[model samples]
Target: MPHRTYLTTPIYYASGAPHIGHAYTTILADALARFARQSGDDVLFLTGTDEHGPKIEEEAARRGVEPIELCDEMAARFRSAWERLDIGFDRFIRTTEDEHKAVVRAFVQRLHDRGHLYAGSYEGWYCVHEERYWTEKDLGPDNTCPDCGRPVRRIEEENWFFRMSTFQDALVAHIRDHPDWIVPEVRRNEVLGFLEKPLGDLSISRPRSRVQWGIPLPFDDDHVIYVWVDALVNYLTASGAVDPSLGPEAPGFEDPTGSWWPADLHIMGKDILTTHAVYWPTLLMGAGVPLPRHLLAHGWWVVGETKMSKSLGNVIDPLQLQEQYGTDAVRWYLLREMPTGSDASYTPERFLVRYEELANVLGNLAQRALSMIVRYRDGVVPEGDAGGLDDAVSTTLDAVAAALGDYRLHAALAAAMDLAREANGYVEAREPWAQAKDPARAGDLDDTLATLARVLGVLAALFHPVCPERSAELARRLGLSGVQTLQEARTDAPGGRTVERGDPLFPRVDV
Candidate 1:
C-alpha cells in the first residue's frame, strides 16, 4: 500500500498582510506535497487564514469596519497571494467557516466531557497583541508580551481552562519515547527543557464581553474560545473529524483512514511548536484522537537578523516577488536556499545570483543539446545503445536516482543537471558539427545525440515536481509524454519520440 502524507502551514493571522514568511512555509509544504504525489503517496496539503482573535478585532475597529468584514477582505488577499504563488493546496480553510466552528466546538466539548476542562476565574496580564494572558514573569522587561512586544493589561474574568499541567509528564515521556517526532535535535531539546519547568493550566476561553470575535464556548455563553484552540482545530476540521456528513471530501480526501489519519507529518514554524507539538498532541490525547506521527518545526525567515514584523516595515509581499520573478523561480528559491529546520534570509542580490546560475549554466546546457539534435537530426530522437555510450552518463544517472530516493531534492536536481553538463562536454569534445561532414563518424553522432536525449529525459522527470510547467514543456520537446515518476522515465522509455526545439527553459531576468 502507498503511504499517505498531510502537510500544513499555520493558518496565517489576518490582522497582518501575507508576507514572504507566509509564502515560504506554504510553498515548502506545496513542494513536499507535490513530491509525495510524484512518489506515489496520497497527499493532503492544507493552508488558510486565522481570522479570529483580539488583534483582528482591534485592527477592524481601528479601520472602522466590522471584524467579519475585515477578515473577509484579508482572507481574500491571502487567497489571491497563494493563487499567484501556485501553492496547490488541497483545501484553504478559514477559522470563521461554519464547518470549522463545529469542529472547534466539538473538540472543546470532548475535552470538557473528559474532565480535562474546568470553569474558573482568572486574573493575569493579557496582551491584546498576543491574544494571550501571560504570568508576571512571562512578561518582558517593558511589561509587555514577550513574543509580540506589546503592552499587557491586567484583567480579571471568568473563563474555561485546559488541564495542560496534568499532561506534563505524559508529554515529556512522549517526547522521550519518540525523539524523532520533533525534528532537529535542538528543537526537541528546547521543547523538553521547557516542559521540565512546572506547567501551567492553559486558559482556553476568553470572556465574550471582552472579545466576541471567536467561536462561542460550548458551555459558557459569556466567553469565546481562545485563538490557539480555534486555530488548531483547522487541522481536524479540514480532515472531516467534526462533520461526519462531509465524509472523505475533507483535505486529505483520498485515504482518510488508511494513510491520512494521524498525519504523517505536521510542518510548522518554531514559534508555534509549543502549540502544535505540545498542546495539540495533548489535546488529541485528551480527546482520544490519534496524535500526529511527526511535528517538524522550522526556523523563521528573519529580516535583518530579526523576525519579520509589520511595525518594522520589513514584511515582504510575496506577490511582488511572484510578479517580478515567475512563480517557479520564487518557489525554487525558497526550497533550494533553506535547509529544513534552518533560517534563510531573502535578498534581491542572492536571488539574482541563483537565477543566473540555474538559467545560464544548467538550463543552457539542456537547451544547447536539444537545439543541436533538432539542427542535425531533423527533430528525430536518436535511439541509445546502452552498451555503446560513454560510461560517465550511466554513472550520473545512478547517482541522481539515489539522491532522489532519499528525499534530497536539491542534491538530486544537481546530479540530474550534471548529466547535461557531461553531455555538453561530449558535444564540445566531438565537435558534432564538424563530425557530421565525415560519413565514417556517423555512428559517433548517433551515439552523442542519443546520450543527450536520454539525459534530458531524466532531467524532465526529476524536475517535474519542482517546476511542473517547465518540466512538461521539456518533456513535450523531447518527444515524451509528461512523466509521472522518475522510475517511469527510466524504464519503458520513449526511445524514438519526435523532438520539438523550443525557447529557453529558464529565461534570464535582470535584477
Candidate 2:
C-alpha cells in the first residue's frame, strides 16, 4: 500500500481579504504536498475559509448584509486567490457545509454525552476583533487584547465549556513522550511551558441570542457553537472521521480507523499553537477521537520589522505578486528563501534579488547548455561516456537527494543549483566554441555537448516541482519525454536523445 500523508493549513478566518500571510501558509502546505507526491506518497491537502464568527457577523452588520452573504462573498475571494497560486488542495472545506456541520455537532455531542462538556456562565473580557474571550492576565499592559490591540469588553453570558483543564497533565505527558511530534524544539518547549501553567475550561459555545452566525448546539436550541470549535473540526471533517466513507462522495473512502485514524501533520501558524497543540488534541480525546500524529507550528511573516496586518496597512496582496511575477516565481522564492519554522521578511527587493539569482543564474545555465546542444548536434541528444565526466556532478546529485529526503527544501534547491553551477564551469573549462572550429576534433565537441545535455536533463527533472512550467519547458527543450523522476534523471545515459531549444524559463519582470 502507498504511504499516506495528510497536511492542512488553518482554515483562514474570512473576516477580510486573503493576505500574504494566508498565502504563505497555504503555499508552504502546497510545497509539502507537492514534495510528498513527488516522493510517491498518497497525499491529501486541506485548506479553506473559517466563515462563521462574531467578526464575520459584525462585518456583515456594518455592511448591512446577512452573515451568510458576507461569508459567501469572502469565501469566493479566498478560493480565487488559492486557485491563482495553484494550491492543489484535495478539498476546500467551508465550515458552513452540511457535512462539516454534522461532523462538528456529532463530535461536540459526543463530548457532552461523555461528560466532557458542561454548562457554565463565562464572564471575561471578550475581543470582538479576535472572536475569543481573554482572561484578565491575557490582556496587555494597557488592558487591551494582545492580538488586536483594542480594549476588550467584559461580558457575562451562558455557554457550554469544554473541560480542557481536565486533560492538562495528560497533554503535558504526551508532549514529553512524543517530542518529535512538534517540529522545531523551541515550539515544543513553548507548548510545554504553556501547559505547565493553570489550564482553563474553554468556552465552547456562545448564546445564539448574542451571536447567531455559528453552528447551533445539538443539546441546546438557543446557543451556537464557538467559532474555534467549529473551525477545528475541519481537520476531521476532511479526513472522513465523520459519517465514515467520507460522506459517500469520496472514492474508496472507508471508516477512518487504524492507519487513517490520526492525521500525519497539522501545518499551522505559531499563533494557533495553543489551539492546535493543546485544545484540539484534548477535545479529540474527550470525544474519543484520535489525536493528530504531529502539529508543526511555523512563525508568522513580518514585513519591514512589522507583522503583515490589514489594519496596519502593510498587507501584501498575493494576487498582485502573482500578476507581476508568475505563480511559480512567487512559489519558488517563498520556499527557497524562507527557512521553515522561522519568520522571514517579505519585500519586493528581496523577491527581485532571489528571482534574478535563480532565473538568470540557474535558469540561464539550462538555457545556454540546451541551446549549444541544438546548435551543434542537429537537435539530437549525444551519448555520454559515464567514465569520462568529472565526479563533481554525481556528488552534487547525491547531496541534493539527501537534502530533499530530509525535508530541507532550501538546502535541496541549493544543491541542485550547485550542479548547474558545476555544469557551467565545465562548459567554460571545455571551451566548446574553440573545439567546434576544428573538424579533426569533432569527437571532442560531441563529448562536450553530450555531457552538457546529460547535466541539463538532471537539473530539469529536479526543478520540475519548484518551477513546474519552466521545468517542463526546459525538459522539452532538452529533447526529454514525460516527467523524469529524480533517480532516472541523475543517471548518465549513454544513448541519450537530442536537445531542442525553447523560450526563456523566466521572462524578465519590470519591477
State each model's C-alpha RMSD to the native: 3.5, 3.1
> What is the RMSD, in Å, between candidate 2 and the native fold over all Cα?
3.1
| Best candidate according to TM-score | 2
**Cα lDDT tens digits for candidate 1, 361-465:** 657877887887888787886665523234664676677557544334456556655665665677788787886788898777777777677667766776666
lDDT of 2 by residue, 343-401 (tens): 88888899998889677877788778767777777777666453334476678767876
Clashes of each: 0, 3
lDDT of each: 0.76, 0.80
Q: What TM-score does each of the candidates earn? A: 0.90, 0.92
Over 4 Å off, model 1? 242-259, 304-306, 386-437
